[model samples]
Target: MQSLDLRRSGAGHAILVRGGRMARLVLSAALLAPLGACGIPYGTGSRVTLSEAPPSAQSTPSEGIMQALTCMRDSHTLNRIRFGIAVHSDGTGKSSYGYEGATGSFLPQGTAAIWASEAVIRAGGLSMNYYELNTERALRQFGGSSLDTALATQQQTRVPNFIISTAFTALDFIGGPSMDIRAGGIGPYYNVRGASLEVSAEMYRPGDRMTMAISSLNRQVFYRDAGIGGGRLFGKGKGELVTGTIGFTDQQRLQEATRDVIALAVADVLASMPVVPDDCRQMVENLKAAHKARVNEDRPQEKPAHGSRARRDDLPAQSPAPRIPAEQGPASGTIANPDKARRNQR
Candidate 1:
């Protein structure tokens, strides 16, 4: 009897365990079924769709350079002077700081070179010899005897009329004394910060070894903020205060400011160069249109208003009307004049 009782107890425990497991399996399936039906993916992979990326913050600087070039070309002051740019140097030899404690040299070498080259090309009065710098560096690397022998034996290389050099002389940041206070569920906060970058640029005639033009430009970029907000409800209230600053330590803004100054400096230097008559007005206009198109492309497309027809601009252009042969009469099944047909019927 005791053995039979023990066997029965063991069977009951097994049944309970099996019932729990079945319930758990059903619950798991119920939980996962909705996800499977919804087509939610599992695992580590992700799906991405191709898209047109928005323009970088550098667009403003590029546009500034373009506008400056256009203006110079329009003024008939820029001549197609052959020139080359040297690597820009940080004369200050000091590191600059941005938001989040980011640090970098006062002058970025790559940026300076690119900005100068672009400005020169866009202004339309300058011919750029891209290999000028490479050739110079190669010659320098060969050193004394080899350089002399190469120069003596090989044909002379074309020298640029002017070599452009730039330096970042100074960078200064000021401000950060900000205050915010909240009382009676209301408060206003204000902050202001400013930064200035000074750049010096010079154009040298390689043959004459003379400085043709020099420009020192100081550009100041600033940030400002002031705001007030408060909320109250049902004899209970919450207060908040916030302070914000802009332009200080903002890398993009700094770069834009630097480009603006560079454009101004380059324009000033190019003003002295000889100007040849070249029709670049159309080119400038085309450039402007391209810039506008890019801007429009990057803008978030607005949805059409409800119940409105599709915009005309979105429609395909209408084709011209097909030419009709004068000798061909109306089709056999078509009436030339509906009014005549109606009169006949009447």
Candidate 2:
């Protein structure tokens, strides 16, 4: 198949572009403003930064790459849904957070604090361990044993590509209210600033040629903070999300992106395997050829004969239907999962 484009301009731009005033104000105030304003006068919104182990802590580039690869190998959707559950089947810990609110009134202090916040509210505040559990489950569903091993072994060289791809897939799901929960707040309260996320993954094969796509998701926001006494003021805040952009923008895009990468990665992996069936090998080649053909068609030179809803619908479907199996899955809401009992016990 065609080569993967690893040089992806992260969703930072998109997020910032979408950020509107809140984001621009943050950057301007944070970077350009005088020193006096930097410390206190300038309102700073929340920031979420993925804190990897210290550079000295890692042994090699491979280690660093593996860590980055978790953006996909792990499952974000499962974690958000499962952890969102506040009560156990037995009944306890019925508390929930991360929903819509206004003026930050009547919201709890700790978990409830996130409600009045925007994306990536606090850098290094969120724990990786808390997120790791759900991602582990997500990895298992994708037939991966462990993100660590998946990133290592030369046999699975394309781990980074897949990880990045999966990250975007999960983001789409999380950010898209249709899949995850999307909350809104009262104006003059919490305004989103800028946001960015980059995810990378790979699939191991004997040689070159793996399928991966980089996606950047970004948004810019604007708002005035309002409250009583300490809370009420002409408070303005700015925030930005600047994770890597090597995956889809949202979840719907993720499903399509993952399947495409899997198809390409599987073909390459099977092509290199010593113990493989001829039928599978042929299938791989066939898929690769098809993908290459489609990519060529997408070149800038080729313009659609007609660009309209009717014309677009007339085009052949590019992907197959998704196969979502039914099981006792976690609910995507607070106070919904049985695991909340476990939290209560803690």
Q: Highest TM-score, which number?
A: 1
Q: Score candidate 1 by lDDT.
A: 0.61
Give the lowest summed-lDDT range of ten residues in model 2.
Answer: 82-91
Candidate 2 lDDT, 1-346, residue by residue in tens: 1222222334565566678778778887787666654446333674444468856652221222223223222323212211110110111122334445433322122331122111111110121222224555666567665755663463343222111112221121122112222223212222222212122222222125443222222211122222211222233564443222122222122112332342233223323332323343344445445444554445554333112112212224633444344322322322476577466457
Tally clashes: model 2: 54
Residue 32 C-alpha lDDT in model 1: 91
Regions of candidate 2 where Cα sits further than 4 Å from its true position: 1-256, 298-346
Q: Residue by residue across 324-344, what tens digits does model 1's lDDT show? A: 664233332136877665665
User: What's each prediction's clash count?
Assistant: 2, 54
TM-score: model 2 vs. ground truth = 0.19
User: What lDDT is reached at residue 135 by model 1?
Assistant: 71
